[model samples]
Target: MEATHRVLVVDDDADIRDLLVFVLEQAGLEVSWAETGEDALAKVREHQPDLVTLDLTLPDMDGTEVCRRLREFSDAYVVMITGRASETDRLVGLEVGADDYMNKPFSPREVLARVSALLRRPRLGAPSEPASSVEEPAPVAGPADAELDVGGGLVLDSARHVATLDGERVMLTPAEFDLLRALATRPGEAWEREELVREVWQGEFIESDFLVDVHIANLRRKLRRAGSRTTWIRTVGGASYLYDPS
Candidate 1:
């Protein structure tokens, strides 16, 4: 049977830990608390929590290092909580692979909202099968569709919704995959933001072009991890980003 959805709350303050546990449990999630980075890692190894709320100031290891190490082992969503609100702090956390951050003295309600959003956000490449069960679908061939090789040691699998880099699977968000496919499919053609909205997003729901930028940034990071560059996408203006095959 699948286990209950778990959240790991890592903070040195016992009161805050208990409070988070109570709130998260009330919100319908299993909760585990750790008082230090080492304990947090151990809990992650033991329970494999679906999400983690990490305190930046750890007694032993720093939160940034903890984040890097955790990413090495799991793809669990991490949200950084700290008293430091410097832009540099936020940037470093993100650069090291944190998905979100919250400042200390934060409202419990806000914390709960962020937790729920992180847990509910749809992940790309997630198994369509029931949770904890492995189901492999039979491969179905695509029609005689045009193939465009996106070099940089990457291969695109539009049919299977997969992307591999140097023979290793590269994980991407759904929006990232959709953006990459849309840009790469046309090779040399540059796509304007509105065009991408109509084509990739299938609607004009996104109000700002930053939506495209955000997804492109995420996609570029994934590609870089695969030892490649997004030399394909070019920025025409604040409103347009184009794809260049070469």
Candidate 2:
């Protein structure tokens, strides 16, 4: 059976809202639309959608504020839509917990593609279950076996989609988790922005380097919040990032 993912489209423009609804519905997703940030929050509370497409400018409040509020009680994937391509704007969106961002004048095809990619990502903090009994067969190793213990009390459990720092759980968006995983898996290797994008976003062509930078910033903030003193992810030159425990 095809999974019926629910998406909440939050935009003030009627044309954009209708267009998003049409495209998302055509893509076999259940979509709900809202014209303001307040309405979007209400709909989110009501529907508990799997994802939300939020516009930066809204009648009641800014999208970043909405995203901040959403993160308080919701884990829904948030994709911010903005007309401005400013680095500050992108960083703010990510800082407030937006999972992704899209610049304005975007194609419905691109929107659908982004939505599909976000939906395909594994849910954060979903842990794997152990065998029921000793008699039960042990699970075979696979991609999940690539888990890493990145020192400084940080552990990345790829199989369970969990990250812990100093024995405290570090909540991360799927993108942030993937980014950390990619860098931690190969510590001390400087990863170019393009390579990190391909690995974390699964080959999606992200046009702006700011996307990767913003997500990295968010990841760092989360690590700090988890009481980490060492800089786990480091910037190399002006272009690449690497995992350096030192």
On lDDT, the leading prediction is 2
Task: Summarize candidate 1's per-residue lDDT along 7-116 as a digit string, tens digits.
Answer: 89999988878888887777767788898898998899999987899989989988888888887776677878888967677667766667667777877676665665
What are the Cα lDDT values of the candidates? Answer: 0.66, 0.78
155 in model 1: Cα distance from truth in Å? 5.7
Top-TM-score structure, candidate number: 2
Off by over 4 Å in 1: 1-4, 122-162, 171-222, 225-230, 239-246
Worst 10 residues of 2 by lDDT: 130-139
Listed per candidate, the RMSD to the true structure in angstroms reads 7.5, 7.1
Worst 10 residues of 1 by lDDT: 130-139
**Clashing residue pairs, backbone N/CA/C < 3 A, model 2:** none
Residue-by-residue lDDT tens digits, candidate 2, 1-246: 233677899999999889988888877777889998888999999999888999999998999999999988788889999998688898889888887888889897678667766666555434322211112222222246455788888988776667888777898876787788878878899999987766666325465488888888888888988888889999999899999876
Candidate 2, TM-score vs. the true structure?
0.84
Task: Flag regions of model 2 displaced more than 4 Å.
Answer: 1-3, 125-148, 203-205
**Residue pairs in steric clash, candidate 1?**
190-242
Clash count, predicted structure 1: 1
